[model samples]
Target: MGQRIFRRVSLGIMMCVLATGLVFAGSPLPNPPHKGEGILTVNIQGVFNAKVSLSPFKGLKTVEPIATVADVRGNKSAKIKIPAQYFPGEFLLRLDYRAKEADAPYPAERIIYINQQNIEITVNPPYINNDEKTKFNSGEKENTVFSAFMKENNAKRMPLDLLRQFLLSYDQPKSKLYTEGVKEFEQRRVEYNTWLANQAKIHSKLYVSRLFQFQYIPAIIWSGDAKERVNQILKNYFEGINFSDPLIIRSRELSRFMDGYMGLYGMQATTVALRDSLFTQAGSVACEKASKGDPQVYGWMVDYFYTGYESYDIKPGITMLQKHINNPDCFTSKKQQITQRLESMARLVPGALAPDFTMNDNIGKSFKFYQWKPQARNKLILFWTTTCSDCLKLVGELSEWYKQPANKKKLDIVAINLDEPEVKIGKWKAVIANLSSWKHLHAEEGVNSPIAREYAILSMPVMFLIGSKNNVIVSTPGTIEQLVKDLK
Candidate 1:
């Protein structure tokens, strides 16, 4: 009986010790053990009828909400369940609330990083960044570490950036002051990069470390003309990037980085033709670099360039995308869209037969896009919408141009309106009343309609000039002036 009593007491002691260890492991301290199933709890005050939304970054500046909680009154708390996929990445929280009883809701957003831990934050929507007004859980590590790093990083980077700028623009390169400035700038840059590298190593296990990689600035040669200096920057652009890590795609920094790189090319372009050539060359070089690193990143680079090229109607750049298109290893999410763009490039060239399609006009009369019969000297097929400001601008310009008797006799236009969401249809109807000179048709499915897919109409204000004799495309004119020139 004494032995049995000892065993029972020992088992109870073991259980108690285990519980204590678990509590201590998750205690309120820096770098506490990660616990919970990726839950975000928001406690907001100073507002009513509050709606909180949690979103994950899919691309630079593009976020889609994963969870939402609505009708949270002032001084109340609400929980948002973050799915497993979104964890281990950065997130954005948006609060929509009303300060007064009748006032319209105001929106405010805060950025936070989540790494499989329960985060509870108290915020006043209007003053979310004020330390006194808002607070996060003391035990949270991901955001805390990131915030501290950025604070120091900005402080370190300011002087270096300013010094470098001064050195680049300083007229007297041989002056003692300029030489001293260059030396100082180089010393500081080396120190900053060293600190950045150390910080990344210290936080190697944290996701925020991946972000630190972008802060690694490459060395630039201050001695040279503008183009030569830009070339030096391009040569070392990927010095600090770890392209093999797919997480770079989840950060907006990547987009900004690419934008800066592309802007370098833009600076050297003096004409439209030169700009197109430089942009395509930039795309080729950048995409090839990424292709050697990660397949997803390679696909992202290809998609980015393709989007830009399509928007600018850069046929050579569009053609350059063909090399990256057929690679099986590329995991670009925009595969279908890319394929459609390539199809448009191949089939929409001059002298090529236009795809034929029969659709009812707004008046229920059937219209054929292409046929053997002749109606006029040339036909213009315009894809547009009332919602798009650019499309509206183009249509307004074209309408005024078409008012001339000679233009009306030479060109017949078929305007395909891609307005939708039912309300836009009402607006389209109202707008087209004054635009009756041109035959109008509405595609109910917007850009996803079969006709749009055939033409690969990804964006607005696309036009095709076709000869009425055999429905062969004469040219894809970007502007009204170009259309007039093509007709001549």
Candidate 2:
């Protein structure tokens, strides 16, 4: 009997492993996509189950497979047709070898361009297939040009990355070595820019291809006093960008570029107040440059910049929109979106009072979030959900900290569970039971709750520190320990 049972278990295991392999062995999508939709056909090099995705994915990463296009068990070759609207834009085609399998190291993702043509790629590694040809059929020119640019970029970027790293290691204006490094870096930049210029001429039709490369120029210019060259170069750098091109607005590359640009320029500001000021000035400069060209392009950029900063420090973004987005009515549709973005942005900045709402607790008791309810004390308002594994651990840590007798009277703690109705309250209640000292409430409509929308609560678990006076938001900390330290 023991041997028979063992034999059955062994057979079951074998079947399971075989089934997993077959599933990832290049199966067709269940629902066939039409030809009009953007199609991707790849003759891959390896025979492993790989995870592929289309970008611009959120936060520069795809945590889960986007089943619509690239999330399949791609073996040696995989073909997929995307929606037609995804064309003539820049996108990243990311692949992770053995991604579905456990303990695989995440590799650097590769970016691909879409030039209103069906994409066909041959994915043999250069080492394996010496010529590194594209085995699949269409969009050969697009792939070939991009392949060369990428090859050149990698070769040239090694020195730049090392120089940039070294420059960042020292104090910016204080160190002579930093100054010397910047001067040397400019020589390399000029050399690389000349090469890029020659390529841009050859691939003139693919001018949109250069916007991202143009965006990669480091914004590390700093001076103790006003430096003419740095200012002039930055001014020319932004001005030369053809925001008149439709592709500049269609792609998220500009948005991504502006974020890093703002960070770099903001670092030059010695004070927090000055940082915000510099960021606002940078936005104005960016918008002024775009508005000087096409209204449609200008409007699109403004809308995108505003949208990008919704979860970020929104004041400078708001300032740019309000001050510089004064375009003619030709862009009426875009103006409306920008207006809506402004209204939302106006309410979500730090030091602004948090809006109030009422929600029921486990026993139907009402909890109100308003000014001065938890009198004479500051508050830590955490927007959390039970379904999130990260939130679970975070809440558990905060609960553990709350258990200490020393922290009980430190401040009032508000934990609003925004878990969907489908998720049983039992899990939420279990977490709350462990955190007995805190005021617990349920977001009546989960993530879309009125309070959540008022706060622009897109992701969790986000925390806002509220001051005692006027119930104004004091800080936004990522962890419980940070919140504790901020409170102290």
Candidate 3:
């Protein structure tokens, strides 16, 4: 009896210890345990299965996100671990919580500065300067200059917005409101421009592209005369832009700004031909500027337009793209990426013959994607991965459409899973259990699947629709809604 009592007491002690450990593990500390390494910790609350990414501010380009954490649960306030590898610089830390709940309150993004110190961030929904936690740290002012400039620049944009309206509103330049608005706008513009110019002087580390946009957008827009403004923009659109600066060429915003400037340049264009001529000349002059001055700039712009124009079914800059692909100055990998981009984009376009491939279904049945019955309906090929949070959401969306009896007969879905072998198919089966009624296939070599290569699956949740007759390509639908609309 004594031996039995000792065993029971020991078991109770073990259970107590486990319970304590579980509680400690379940409740994440405000910050991750500092291991004396350079791991930057992020504590997230009120969100689940979030994707944490860091995009560094090294150049004037869109810095592709560096995925620090793929999917993290929000329960118990999770702490994300990220080691700082970038040189002391500013970066955008984005928490893509779309994978979790749609109504999650956390701000999607925040700017972070790495100063060779282990930084800790506590992310909660509706990120405000003050609520319950610590106030905004003023000690880190130099690190925060980007946000400050952005705020100031946004505040000063009212004058430009007014000027644009003034240009568009009045045919008569002599109207009292238009004249006075333009004059007042011009004065504010000078003051704003001076302020932007001094930002870099104030914070030596301020990104040049940010300052350029804040400066040039105002200088070009807040003019007193419409015709003069148009001419000034067209003639010197890229005057202050230093193409050699890696920041300008790398900034996606700069390219977006250029795209907008062309559209905004001649808002009161008299004819369709006039607008076309203006845009065509914009591209031509942009190319010439790059060709003569900065080859890198020229190459970057060629890529920008080649990829950009193709999406709208407009192939304006193919010649330039081809030239850069063959250019000696271009890196082999970039050239390859550009070449692949052309081939894939050109192939997948509407009316192009759909790339054909064979893959084994969930039941080990080999099926050809192009084999659709002549009398049957259109075909929809969905490329997704088991681990892709977006893809999981997409499956749910498609499943909803498919549940309707009408959609099943109107469209045939060929769901392809790009989950590798080592991950095991059990988890994938569990995830796709809801869509069991639909035909699903698994790639033998996940990412290197032939279909993915043929279509160039650069991103997840990519869908293709094919016309029933001759299996002609229809369109790459962005959403299930688009696919349904196209079917009609």
Which segments of model 2 are wrong by more than 4 Å?
Answer: 1-35, 48-78, 94-110, 123-139, 153-192, 212-233, 249-253, 294-300, 303-320, 323-356, 362-411, 419-434, 444-447, 454-488
Tell me each candidate's TM-score: 0.88, 0.63, 0.56
Error of 3 at 396 (Å): 10
- Pairs with steric clashes in candidate 1: none
lDDT of the structure predicted as candidate 3: 0.57
Better of 2 and 3 by lDDT: 2
lDDT of 1: 0.76
Q: What is the lDDT of residue 424 in candidate 2?
A: 68
In model 1, which range of ten residues has the least summed lDDT? 16-25
Question: Number of the top candidate by lDDT?
Answer: 1
Better of 1 and 2 by TM-score: 1
Clash list (residue pairs), candidate 2: none
Candidate 1 structure quality by residue, lDDT tens digits, 6-109: 01122112111110000001111222224434689999888775799998875565477887897788889989987666657778889998887698989998
lDDT of 3 at 100: 55
Task: List the candidates ranked by lDDT, beginning with the highest.
Answer: 1, 2, 3
